[model samples]
Target: MDARLMDATFSRNQPSDARRLYDDRAIRYDNSWHPRFARHMVELARIHSGERVLDLACGTGLVTYPAANAVGPTGSVVAVDISTGMLAQAKAKQADHKHENVQLLQHSVTDLQSLLQLQGETFDVITCVSALVLLERPYEAVKQWATFLTRGGRMIVDVTHPESQISLITFERVGRKLGRPVPFYRVPFQSPDDARRLLEDGAGLRNVVVHSVSQMDIEGRDDLQAYLSDIQHPRIEQAFTIGDADRLFDKHITDWAAQSLANDDIKQKARAVFREEWVKLADASGQIREVDEVFVAIGWKQ
Candidate 1:
């Protein structure tokens, strides 16, 4: 979390790292935070039956599978990702769900133009969700992706508000407490204007529109803890050995607690206070609630 450490982590945001990280995470990625917003993107795109669709960075087929269903068997979906692990999982899901309209491809977005040419294809709808920020030059990438769309075809891109998730906030808080800086690898697309500019101006797409969607969900306390525990923070493996990092984190928490509380009784009281604060985060379901905002940008190929 030190500046140098953070920089090192950010440097690993290349295609190779993404492949390895996602390969390890393919089995669990769908069950994680991303799929929650994937459905919304598919819905917003309004993919119609018989339309040809391309799902870029289609991790575990979250958006791809749904889009296939929306388009029905008459349509087709080309789902591509850099990670073989993710594509494998997606293929498995595609088989299990019987989404015969979907096809899987392992290619980075950087190579999409050439790949499309090799396949001699174009699409009616092109979607890249929660993965644009990972690109080194999102503007250029968008521009390239747009070239693959048919005239009047729609291109949809979505990104999360950088600070909107509870897990992110918790990581930042803990980092600050320990005098470390939590690093974000993705380029921040934190506002609607950001999305608009990237699409309409950067990509030269016409009739661009951006929409913001907010979702709140209640999670059980134990469930939240387990979720946090499994978080493989970007480049975390390079930072510290597995159990060592958790031990260091626990020590920091202990030190912070000791400095803030006078005795065991006060420490217990402090714990209760924090627990109530967390509980207050819950919605009517009496589960810990986390609120997040997702921005979806739509543009048409002119």
Candidate 2:
């Protein structure tokens, strides 16, 4: 995804960035976070051949692709997002796979009525993944989405668990620096209880089931270590958040770039310092004591 596109969507238009970023970063996201999150919904929906599914905020076909596959040749997936760039990437990806079951659209969850109006359609199942947190009014969005589901049809949503927003901190060794404390992060709610109540009891969706999952990358995977190093990469100035902390220990790669390149000794020391400091921070935070949980809420249309 191009940074320009990301900035255009997220930073430029605060209200509509969700659609834009998904369009811009849709392809990049598939390799990073989409597959892991999509599995839960795909399983819950139990997409059978010939069934129809609506993937709201489908962002570059992460959930859409799998759902398309599950439904086999007979099923069709209407994957919607606001970003055309993201949809373009998804289309490119689909072209590569020769998948005919997936259809990409430029749409948002809040405008479901208009979307339905355009397509003259409804859905048997609707799924959204990690895209609801940005909604200014999630309840209203859910209520609108409810109209599209047939009775007994399912709506599965995955969002940042409220509990996942809390920060927990602690210390560990950074190379030779012993007992330096670091930030530990945790979320606040396993699920949004209030939202769940409103949708199930208030809005009339039924049989809401919230499932929690923690996909940890701390151990036994070279890929994760490489990815973590990149995430904490010095050139990246943006804060990577876990839980509700305002900031984590700074990864000031820019500050050390020149010295690190000019002197092997400097680079070694820099790596050691960062490694120990991050370890201490993670250990001190006490986040490792418990698995970080992401919530998946599944319900039937009333």
Q: Highest lDDT among the candidates is held by which one?
A: 1
List, residue by residue over 253-289, the lDDT tens digit for candidate 1.
Answer: 3331122222343434444443443443444655433
Best by TM-score: 1
Report the lDDT tens digits of candidate 2 across residue range 1-302: 32222222234232365554344455566675456556656876677777889898777677888888888788788888787777787787797664587777776667777764335677888887767655656667788887878787888875543323222211111211422111111122234574466468634798786655443443454232232221111122222323312233222322211112113334355355544443433344434222345556778886
TM-score of each: 0.67, 0.64
Compute the lDDT for candidate 2.
0.55
| Prediction 2 TM-score vs. true | 0.64
Give me the runs in candidate 2 sitting further than 4 Å from their true place: 1-15, 116-119, 165-192, 201-203, 217-291
- After best superposition, candidate 2 residue 20: deviation in angstroms? 4.2
Stretch of 10 with least lDDT, candidate 2: 179-188
Pick out the ten consecutive residues of candidate 1 with the lowest summed lDDT: 229-238
